[model samples]
Target: MRHRVGPRHARRPAPTLLRGIYLPRSMDAGAHAMTTFGIPLLVLATTNSAVLTGVAFALEWVPRLAAFALAGAMVDRYGASPVFRTASVLRALTVVAAALALPYSDGVGATVTVMLLAASTGVLSEFSYIAAETAGGAASRAAGSRAHRVQSVLLGIDQVGTLAGPALAGLLLERYGATGMLTVIAGFSLLAGLLAPRQRDGRAAGLPEPVMKGLRTGWSTMRSLPTLCWLVVGLTLSNLAVGLLQAAAPVIVIQHMGRSSADVGMIWSVAAVATLVAVALWRRAIDRYGLWPVGAVAAAIAATTCLAVTLTHTYTTYLVLIAVLMAAEGGMTVMLRTLRSHLIPASAFGSTLALSALILLAPFPVAGVLIAVTPPALLVHVMTGCAVLQAVGLAVTFARLRAAPGLRTALA
Candidate 1:
């Protein structure tokens, strides 16, 4: 008979590789599937006019800002896993509804209304994403790096989907028309919903406290910590800068370069590839050096890269600039996510994390408006300035954190 023994007196326990590393990758795939279907559905269902499309797109962000706070509180009350599963299913159902509505819309007015409804429903998925990250906990911050590594990997995959979804939608639309495309989207949504149940067994049994209690607890906890407060503030500013840059990228490519759709796709693909590589490298670096220095370096690099974008005119030069900028952004993102995982207690995890997301996302509409109103030259200038500000803010925050013994130890 084979004998299995516990660690003997003279021996140590075997080192085990963490399984949580795979969890982020899986969650990321699920996120990619969700976004892939959601974005195309908006595109496929909308009128071809840029103005109408912009209006529909703008509606999507509206609910995201409005509902984020409540979603965070509810996530704490219900627990991340359960909330994630429920929202996934709800999002799938909403997509299915959008699929149904697509066939009926005859013109811009009808299409806009249906697309607006679709975008509104899609916001729920964002809530579920925040919850999933919260559930990741310290496993999210394993090896001194944060969820950013996982986020970057997943985001890379998501970008692939972003690249693929439109092409797939176009093919499907050509083959099966609007109805056929919607059917394909519905299938993706169903897959996403099915994936949710696998997150954690028995997650439903541990219902959190009431929403009010959870909010109060989260508020108290956040208010008590100076590090958490400043971190959120800095991240919020960073995200605002990111949002503006993102909204402006396509506009710059289209207007400045007079690029066709294919060229635009190529530019984005290059940026995505760069982000993926930077993130993978940043993850390794963070595991070795820790988040503070990695983040500081990333911020500085991002600032320079953003400024470089304004100077580039040729397609190759612009692509190179974008790739470099995205790399830096990807690195900073990983560090910030890791820091967020560290700062919050497990019990208040979802709410606190969600609050940070809410704050960070608060300026998206403003960024979008800036994209709409400002001249391309002015917008690019503003984005470069913002990137510089983000670098300075992150540096200052890092300095404050390094000086404070409690915060420094926590970060380390």
Candidate 2:
């Protein structure tokens, strides 16, 4: 497909690698590192219970099922930049509060309270992210490619931070305690907040209509597009598998394999590094075969690799399988994101993209709960089976869409 700017807006100069791209990439790396690493370690160190850890994870994701629609509406109404900046500041403050509250929580109630607050802030930050990317025109195949490149680089950096954050958290916990580690997280969050500038494009100004109206419009557009809807379905099932695996893997590794928390972190770090390499190499793959085929292949690879994890009896084999799983997930994620951008319209960008999250991420809580209750072996089997089904479903849907004359015309 050819990439072209529409006549409705005059074409601006092509974005530079330095100014237009690298700045947001840097911001994402810092923000993701602080949240992904800090939140889990803080809970693990403070609460120190698997049940509570599961609760914390649930609190973080459960509300996104509902709130994302409204957040998307707000983005469409107010524009993305202001909301993005405001959410970042709020997230930074929330991190600071959780840091402060870490020492005071002696039991489940206090820990739950602190966790809920942190989780809520994370949702807000996520909403802002969806809005910003959508408003930046990251949905078009051409625009999406640029966004994917930025994400690839940022995620590669985030892998480094993932390795660093847990190790740093462990050391800080040993030295200055949980409070010291949290303080460092807060500092990093505040710095990320400070770096956010107003929208580089003028899309952040005046609303075109009421928030409700915009949402309806976006919904109508999405329903009219079968490929996009099926894509959301595929993504939702994929996320369910991921959530189950994440919740179950630690228990399996620790209980079955007799490993320590440090071992879990190390295994995850190996996966992260593998993901970084896969994402770096994925651009070439995308450039060669296009996003759809690459995404389907990646999904199949992910399902098989995750299933292989359940079969491994040795640590070295387990680590290798996990790394392969992470690499496949990383590569698939890049393609899925780019595909979402290509399918959605510019005007309804945030709300439309938010729907993808609403569908995919909303089920995570249930998945986590199932993991907490089910046997590890059974859970692994279920997760792998679901992943295989999702991969097959996505492949079939893509084939059907590709064969449809109407879709071909619309996409053309």
Candidate 3:
């Protein structure tokens, strides 16, 4: 009789998931950030109108925010590979079309063209992102007990992309003009599409779900998972405080603190570094202390730093506090991602991911409204109010999680 191989030994060798999934993800994310940030600056340059620039910002983000649910549904129905590849290819084409159109258009025509490009790309980017996120979620689930390590690395990769993307966008725009910058973005987007892994054969592709129905499904998934719901609630409150601080950063730095616009960028650069460090540390921390304790500690640190930021009189102090706050947030994010992979069923992962993201992001526009209406001198006070709410909410959330009998195995 011939010798038989065990299942593990018989499995075919494959490229590491990190190289196959995350490398392309980084390219996609950076390109999206470049286009999103670059377009507003381009609008300002082309129109010489701050109003149009502000319009460009809204056009870019509003559509992106709207696309999450639909994109998530598409990912669930069709699978991540096909959705990501199609959206990325379409995004590249859109950018190239805009670049080709820009030279011929003049004044209002140029402004309109750019705004349309922003809206289109914004929607496409969300589709790609949701698909990629679903793909990552599948990979995390396969990792089983080591899932948080996967999540920490993924979060770290995102932080790096976010840190580098804007600066790269500005540099390319300054050196190469609209066409050059757009062309570079298109290249990255195309590369991301080309690099995406092929879909596995076993998963079924189905008819597109209605957007509203998909959202309802996502909502149902959340309702089924009380632990996930409570974590989202705490994070949403934390984000409200973070969002207020972010929206108020430029005004506080340039007007209240008497710092240049350049300093605002520097502050974020520092904070991003802090976040990266925290993400790196989370894996080891989780290994030693487990997820719940690590998350609770992170929450406490974030809440403390958020409150302390209100007392800062100097730019340096504000910068340090913000960095610490972001670091803590990074740790919490890793914990969230790990838990999400464990809790949400694979069948609803895409749709539920969309709903969770929407909830987390809802605070941003609210923060923007607060910043727009509040006096600069009162910004700290607004942040203080948000911080207190975040602290109490998270404290309560963790306390509940700790006491809940249903969550012990999952948290363990």
Candidate 4:
């Protein structure tokens, strides 16, 4: 049997430990931001085709849903360290290749190549994301009672990436072409790989099942939790609304609002600031006020933001509303994470969280395709209807969660 380390054993200082954890995560976030913003910008710049831009967007996300369950289950058996390190290295190498090769391709070939890159990047990034979250748990265990504080700091760091990453990418893209921007992104991803820590106790000896069996077990665990399932469904609906904004917002800002891609990056950068402020405000209140109530309020803000977008065409108005929506999104995200932790079993986190993410995120690329095909006027109406559906679904779910007797005790 394994034994615990004694008091005499030397433990790393919290700052040193946190540095090891945050450095990779911070760099990874930068890489993620660059990929998210750069791909669409590169596609549009190359093709000047909205349909192709949407295709690139779809390429990036659709594979994530396909990969998440497998990634999660793989992490369960093999540990996150190797998976993270290998994936980051692959991302670095792939992007480097893309930078060198992409300019040589013809129009049809370029579209196909970029989409393939997006798909591969999507798969690798999903593994990294699951690894980071798992690493956070390890970091928290090391921090002991300060786990919540550690998580808050991590959340803040993520916000910083979102706040600055796009702006940084936009600056680079504006000054340097796609190849230069990709080179920089590859560097960040490489840094993340190099900085990744290998926990001495990272492997899960408990999960020795075959790959397919492990996958099935995870699905069973996730489906058994009705509350969590409902929560995912509600969040999935919210993600569809999010997809509408994400896929449409860039098009709207550039085509409808007559701005540069840099402007769209700036808009997201501003939303990140708003999200940071919201996180600061909501963190304390969530611990005090509980999930359903705070979640309901956040839902209202989200719906209001969607409605405001429908009513405005001004660049400034769209920016402010996106900021508001992102703020609400940040708060709701924290609440949902906390709530999911409460509802999900400890053993099920890896697989179940992956399943949940698959559902919640699947809408992203679908939104892109929808935006691509839908006419502009009709798309606006589709978004408006999405907002209504989001509000109603969240309201009902929160009501159900509030009414459940078992959940009442834990709600606080």
lDDT of 4 by residue, 295-396 (tens): 668878987787777788799988999899988877777766655555555555667677778878988998889878888778779888888887777777
**Candidates 3 and 4, the one with greater lDDT:** 3
Q: What lDDT score is found at residue 6 in candidate 2?
A: 80
Judge candidate 1 at residue 289 and give its lDDT.
69
Determine which window of 10 residues in candidate 1 has minimal summed lDDT: 13-22
Q: Superposing all C-alpha atoms, what RMSD in Å does each candidate have to the true structure?
A: 6.2, 6.6, 4.5, 4.1
lDDT of 3 by residue, 72-183 (tens): 8888888888889899999999999999999999987888899899889988998988888888888899999888877877887777765666556656666777898899
Deviation from native of the Cα of residue 98 in model 1, angstroms: 2.3
Off by over 4 Å in 3: 1-15, 35-58, 99-118, 173-181, 200-206, 250-263, 310-315, 373-378, 405-412
Q: Please state the error at residue 109 of candidate 2 in Å.
A: 4.9
lDDT of 2 at 192: 48
lDDT of 4: 0.76
Tell me the deviation in Å of residue 102 in model 4.
Answer: 2.3
Clashes of each: 2, 2, 0, 0
Among all candidates shown, the one with the greatest lDDT: 3
Per-prediction TM-score, please? 0.76, 0.81, 0.84, 0.89
Candidate scoring better on lDDT of 2 and 3: 3
Candidate 1 to truth, TM: 0.76
